[model samples]
Target: MLFISAITFGADYDSIGDSTIVRKRSDLTQKLYDTLLSIKGNGIFFGMQHATGYGVGWQNNNDSCDIEKVTGDYPAFAGWGASVTDCNIAQGEGFEDARYKIKLFHDMGGFNTMEWHADNPFGGNCYWERRHDKTKDVVASILPGGEKHQEFLTQLDNIASFFNSLIDDDGKKIPIIFRPWHEHTGAWFWWGKGNCSKEDYISLWQFTVNYLSDEKGVDNLLYAYSPAKNDSREEYLYGYPGDEYIDVLGQDNYYDLRQDATNMPRFVKMLETLVSIANEKNKPAALTETGAFTIDAKATMPEDNWFTEKLLKLIMYNDKTRQISYAMVWRNGSTSHFHVPYPGHPAVPDFIDFYNHPYTIFMSDMEKYRTKNE
Candidate 1:
């Protein structure tokens, strides 16, 4: 499959030097285009990060409990986060679970995306609490020939091995969107705005991708570059590692972080910004992470139809915003930290309505997308 340097997003997909990777990426991209493109703009896909195979309901009940266990259905896209704590942790049980879920989603004709919550290489700092003081010099350590550079490579190699291992029943590589160093605009993570220079960040990104694609020979993945919400396109693309290194233009935002529902003007504005940038760049854009972070819709039922009223309305109703390929909510970690609603939860009725909406595509709907594309 011959590919060009510049890709017209909705029309074609770009390559990153690997033939197998190029084919898989192009196939997935075409699938996305077929599913989303419509005469009346496009359809938006509903997603949930770390949803089935693990969730708040599972934490509260049995490990077998999941979105399908409760609601009898799954989201169109499922996300997983791998943490490179010890250099070889990607080969451990946690990562094995993630791989299992990825295969499960693929077998069902749904999509899968993975991101990293990399630990600070210089010290004992974890992803969530990566303060500047704790991991300020970490990025430098991971650059070529830096003190921790070799250690970082070990992590990437293991991660690449995992990506390469995701083969389907027919012995074909399964495609997945791989997002790394997400929420770079936030002040928390070690790789965030204050911790590293744009030069260093771009190098980190390019090096990681090259090591994965060239050195490790992993070709079943598409790279996604996601940052925290920023108002202007300039601010959003400030540290971007250029078009060749990225396949998906995505953003991560939470309702609680923005202090409002999905209909919030600020939220809509950022969505517009992402969509406009994607359209101009001829790339696919997505609301990579979102949802009511802390609200227990079941207990409080605070905002009725938060799904259809706020979120679905914002994505499905708008002409331009509807072009966003997908919108994913964060993980349902616990009863206190859950994002999506469980079965019999107060938001179930509204979520059901959102799932039923023609513009909002979920897991079962993917069969139609596959048949249409076929």
Candidate 2:
């Protein structure tokens, strides 16, 4: 019921075959559609940053399993990773001087969905930015919702408008792989900071889906629900919108031996649990975010290497699985530099071997959604 069998071509997506909505320029929309198709059946949707504006092209690279896949950017640092841009022009080349820049990413191989963020589930106040308490910053809400709640709605509306405009090459809607409020189970980000109650967060999520599809009339979307490893609350992992609202289920794991105790058991278990739930619900699952610190952390090599080997094999195999569809390894060289050097990993390592073997056989061919290598 929840699992919808799908094949990602490029990025082109039409209204459930029978809806009428003026999408964005057909050319751009189609390119995205094809891109989705290219990786649809596969288990990995390698991520790119929406923060940095686009370059001429994008690449996934060999370090992680993504390997040199071209990438692009949205207007300004506006990847669905966070919240959408403000120009308020959420979608495309809307002819607005566009306070919102529309060219953030490069069109390397191009992509399927134009992911932008509305607001993170973590709270509005971030540690780095917008540290001001929501009570202090946003004007009080006049309507039923609180002021901060109202502001979140505005951001959500703006984002809806942006994604709703995508059109296929033949003047159809470009379906998006919408992964919003992702990684909410973790407390690092603002939304998951313990301020938002489960009910409140759920309201926010439900309201977002209602407004985006029902009110905004954006049909080109395949919602994805992702949670971070070592979730602070189990509700965050289970609090997904109904099947109609979600398409893929995934988890984010970054704690390697270099960071956490020993690899990402919590993350692996998180996936195992998620897969069981997804199976019950019928939706497919994926390793949406995964990576070992290429740099280095406290852990030394053999142990860390052991972690990687065990980790890769653990999630990539076993009975509970057969649910994983893709695995996107985060190999952002810049990111590796940004974080403290992973102790053992002064240099980032490549997952090409992992991807090349059983761990990734499903990539080239999506016939069986099982861990290829063990």
C-alpha lDDT score of every prediction, in listed order: 0.69, 0.44
Q: Candidate 1 overall Cα lDDT vs. reference?
A: 0.69
TM-score of each: 0.85, 0.61
Each prediction's RMSD to truth:
4.6, 9.3
Tell me the tens digit of each residue's lDDT in model 2 across 192-272. Answer: 436445555555556666667667766666666777765433654555544545666666666642443554566556667
What is the C-alpha local distance difference test score of candidate 2? 0.44
Question: What shift in Å separates residue 228 of candidate 2 from its native position after superposition?
Answer: 2.1
After TM-score superposition, the amount by which residue 263's alpha carbon in candidate 1 deviates from its true location, in angstroms, is 8.5
Error of 1 at 232 (Å): 0.8
- Checking candidate 1 for backbone clashes, the offending pairs are none
